[model samples]
Target: MALDVQRNWDVCMAENLERVTKESDQPKDKKDARETTRAEKPKIWKSEPVYLPDEIIIQILEYVSRFHESQYTLASCCLLSRQWYSAAVPMLYASPYLYGKNFDPFQAVMIPSRNLHVRDSPLASLVKILDLRGLVHQASRRITARLLGRTKGNLEAFIAPQASFGTNSFAALAKCHQLRILDLSLVSESPPLFELLKTVSRLDNLTTFRLPRSSGFSTDVNPALITWPRRLENLALSGGIDAHFMHGIVALPSTLRSLTIEHCPSAKGFALMHMLRAAVRPLAHLETLKLANLPRLSGSACDNVLFILPGLTRLSISVDYITPALFDFDVSSHREAIECHYPTLPHAESLPTRHQWTDGKQCELRTLELTNSGNPGVEDKVSPIDIVIALDEGALPNLRQVRVDKTLLWQASATAADVDALADALKEAAVQRGEDESTSTGVWTF
Candidate 1:
């Protein structure tokens, strides 16, 4: 009976081992499916996007466009959707900051194909400012002309390239009636003065015009024939304009507000003074005058500036052309000479009568900027004490701000007291004028 029980137990143990082996050999995927089936899985809900109004999107984009590096962000936004592209494209092309690497693609888009029949690019009209001053050899005359032709409809400001702009570009320039600022200061070779003036005369909307630094006002054209834009307000003259052309301008527009003269290799003190007396001073609205980098002017050449332009409110001149005597209250001789000619001056209707002139004291000058134009030993030309004495003497009653270059060393320990005195004087002046601290009169150095 014990032997029979042992055999039965062995047989049962073999069967149990076989059953466990079969269970283990079954496919693993089926077991996993069974285990997963026992648990509940979460359902994914597909929802529609919230619609935003076009006006709201545009307002958001306008806020983003205020960043300095917003061009890249705007370009990225163009790829989002049709609404985004339409809103971002105008802001992206309105003021394209062109450089060497990206100029080719810009030109391609501006002038899509060589063949004229190809549809004109709708992107062309969106450009408002086409500044090519950064490009050196990337553009040609033909390309500049074509670009101008494409963008002339709404081009408000154009900064010509250094080498590519020429007379060929004038035809398209004449058609840019909407152009407001034309800056050719970086141009290496100026186009013909006659053609340029003639082309620009038609732009009634032009307000600011800067002549090229390389402009050689050769005597081929008569200065009398040069007609300035009627609405021109700001004019910067540079380059090789000689005394004859400088003094021969028939009449500066009455709308001129600011005048800048610099880098004139041929300008002399007498010629400039004559031009100011004859052409510039008569303007009723002339307020700001800037002179710098004039090679021929002496240290005292501009001493009588405050005496000449009695109505001028702002003056920016290099220390190389001025002295402390600029603020002298005794302009008896200058007054006598100017009084003799004031009646005969053009635009006499606008000139304050001889009695209206300040009695040898200029009180209208509000801001003065003294720069260093490569002059040695210029630190001692004008000092803080000089300005303080002038203020005490009541020469510059309305003088609000004075800016000096670092070369003057006004910040040195030797002049610390003088600098403080100047600041205090300005603060007192500001208080007298009832101005707040933010707009207070002060001496600032750069």
Candidate 2:
């Protein structure tokens, strides 16, 4: 009985017409009383079909195609006219989402009798995003490679299938000049590191790339650091990445903007710190830094590098890795070592709550996401309170928002006291900033 506007429009119109027909056949007594009925509504009629330009119509259908969940309505639009077919077909083919139920039929259309007939179809050229992540054991690897071969020219963002994407697809993937985002994070059996690097390095236009989980890969594999793709801006490495790859990384490309290192067990405290200073610090454009689930990272190693990041804007680090010293406004030992190199003031006391480098550029930090990443409350660690104390003291002057896992952090009694201290710090910080706490909304209670 539930009516969907997109799917049931014609049916609803027919039902309305039928009701009007039924009303005309009513008895004289009923007709006299019928003005009170809901069916007595007036209609706004137009004699000619509305003349919508092709461009406007296509634009309207494009929005419909993206906003609607089910494609039944889109498929119906294609049957309306040749003009509609041309407009809706491209939108439909732009991102063909295939799952277990439709996988076989889609496979047949893409590769009929093992021959790719994609070129014969206009719809195939419009394919841009082929998200095969949902496909698990639905088709063979050969079928996937065939589709990639057909769509390689125009494909932009491809998240490979979890199970079936393999070596055969590499040739087609490398040839995709328009390729930008390549995410193989869910790949079950990772291809050899040497081959993966060689294959991906050929993609000149690739921007956002995520390496496969290291667990599915061989530990013996040592991939030599080569010239990474010129356009790569974001890189995420996970799954117990081998130390050789981490240590071998001389420096990320200057174009690199964001770097994420998570669940990397081999890269310990000093190892990670060394990697950051050597490989990461060289990138002038690096803005976002995320380190999490790094168990072996000592608090001191994290303390050494974070403050010196030239362009860090968003930092999400595990609470376990960072220490209270990070919030300290004046530490003479570090000042003498680090400050002397910069042309700026030698004393930490001269550093602004909102930091500016010697170049006179304001620090870009806007959001800080401090998380435990599931480490239990422990002694000799920086908690939420320490951060509030720092903020109140005018550290991280441009800091606007902070995110932490409240549920996990508040489970134990020992940490609960720290939460109280955090509350006091936040209140005091708010007061120090001359904020009208009573009027300002969105303040979290616990």
Candidate 3:
């Protein structure tokens, strides 16, 4: 019986071994089938690699180029493919405005060098404007010198303020033949600053220019070199500007439409009024004039100058003082001076004579803005009654819209009841004159 059992065991062991062998073979067969399928499939042409269309890649490059200092990353993209390199190279050198603190030394060297490569690239002709500010001091002067040497003709607008370079740097900038708009503000260094201005004046194409504070030009300096551009439309001068600068500005081509004078502390007493009258008399097409932070001139000085600008549609004057003479037909010495100086103005016509100037004339003044911070003992000491009288007589006659800050009216001590009374008076006057009272708009609040 033991022998029979042994034989049965042997037979079962053989059957189990055969079953394991079949299971192993089954796995091998499946593996071979997969291998055959992979081998039989046509090989994809991946060795050469399919790439995005050139136009799409170019678009991505253009998008990245819009960033100020994207040149490094964009240039690195060139290594991806010849097509990518070609697409990114031009945009890398496009109009770049360099400002703020992040601008480092490496970027300065790289930007101009990259620009050199870009100038040689298909996109070299595309760059137009270059704005270099505070961060330029970090760059090697050599890099700036090189850039100024290379792309001088293509640069249309150049803005560099408070840059640490010397007059030599500006001399390099002057070489740019196509320079049109130049803003050199906050540059305190006199040698480089003057040299830069001198160079700018020589550029026949220079149309728009901004000087740093009022100290840009010497008081005794002749402004004949600072001629107005036929294309020049906007001029902004700070209070530090000397009377000679004003003379230069007034002598500019009549094409000027906007003039902004701020913080002219040097223009104290009657000189401010004299400067305004002289500066504005020739600007026939003058549309907008802004004067702010002027401590020397009073509200009366503003009115005296404004009436001379008949074509003026928008006027903004922020002064510390307000007076009834500002709006009233007061024949004081100041009024007499205005009449004697500017005979064409309406204020001069009714001098000591209360003739209605607005009787036949269409109201040309569209907007009037008066703003003052009613700081105790700091701003104007005029009463609200004086301000109201000024508005009633001076403002209501020609202004279509008036914007008076609460601080200014409060300084004048005008109450809500006073405002209502003034509005009613304006309406009554407009009705009597057959004019539209609805056209009058006033904002008492800030």
Candidate 4:
């Protein structure tokens, strides 16, 4: 009986030993599985610190002066580093002018439906500027509505001609409260151009405005022409605009500093002179004035306008018909005109006389550019080169820098001897005036 009991105890001890070994192995297996998971974990790359500072990035962007060619590359720079992105995105989106082809992709995707609304979509926030050129087809109305719905409050500038902004486009644009600038230059077919302009009058932020050839709007409307933004400064007008329109424009915000009138044919020489007389009185803040490609501006009219706005620092006038005879200063017309119109103010003190034909006695005239008689006509008998020489020596006594367009120089029939004589005269004049004898004067010849 004692042997049988000892055998039973040995059997029980074996079973206990087996159970202990299984329990220990199970914990080891779990620990091994955990170790395998840790060893196989995936690695991720961390973002690197930006190498350049923000100011340096801005300076680099400023150095990239040619915007059109470099804009795409510069825009991509935004994705490269956060600093580069912040600096380039504003410039990239600042003056967004869209041509005709830019609307293709948008048009393809914007499947028109009576109930479609872009405002409900998540893609609405990406758009800031919309250029709807040659987009006035049947699909235009729907596309314009969608675009406006998406960007009504966000859009800052809209540059579309009259045709693109038919009734529907106009209605959509009317909702754009944040619009600051409008360029309506390419629309020649649409008659409701004035209506579009009238709609924009409600925009308190509308500042810079460009109008194409035709005063169809000005003729019909007599209201205050522009209720521009308080910050409105630059205005560019092309083709023929009426005198009344000019007056209304000048009456806009007094902050106007730059004004450009290009290819305005209806502005007769004398009529423009009178308009300048009336307009320059209030636009004393104007610093830069450019009148280019106007066919009717006579030399006398140009001179009269210049005398009226003597406070102008940068003046660009391209009147090919002007002659010295125009400067004959008829007592009845010019003397009283100059005295009455030219104001002697503190701003006039800094006016550079580099191109003004004045006796060098502490004169105030900064930069003067004049182009005359580049076209072949009976009127261009006097060589422009000789006139330039005479003006440099006599009229522009305080001359600092002069740029003569090559068109005038190429048309001049002066011989080599004449050219040499003119150069010598300029050298003598420079010496007498105690001015640096640098070739700051450029003669552009086409």
Best by lDDT: 1
Best by TM-score: 1
Better of 3 and 4 by lDDT: 3
RMSD, model 1, all Cα superposed?
Answer: 9.1
> Taking the candidates one at a time, how many backbone clashes does each contain?
0, 1, 5, 12
- Model 1 per-residue lDDT tens digits across residues 273-384: 8788788877879999999999998888888777778788999999899899788746353553464446565543455543456544445888888898998999899999
Better model by TM-score: candidate 2 vs candidate 3: 2
Candidate 4 per-residue lDDT, tens place, 189-264, comes to: 4435457556766777777777665535457666365455566677776765766565554464677887887767
Task: Flag regions of model 1 displaced more than 4 Å.
Answer: 1-47, 115-117, 333-362
* lDDT (10s digit) by residue, model 2, range 60-159: 8877877647366777888988888877877877887788998887766665555555234445568899889988899678888888887887999999
> What's the TM-score of each model vs. the native?
0.84, 0.74, 0.60, 0.60
Model 4: weakest 10-residue lDDT segment is: 357-366
Candidates in order have lDDT scores of 0.86, 0.71, 0.60, 0.59
- What is candidate 4's TM-score against the reference? 0.60
Query: Where in model 3 is the C-alpha error above 4 Å?
Result: 1-93, 97-102, 105-127, 134-147, 191-197, 214-216, 224-226, 244-250, 295-300, 321-334, 340-363, 367-446
Give the RMSD in angstroms, all C-alphas superposed, for model 4.
Answer: 15.0
Clashes of 1: 0
**How accurate locally is residue 334 in candidate 1, as Cα lDDT from 0 to 100?**
59
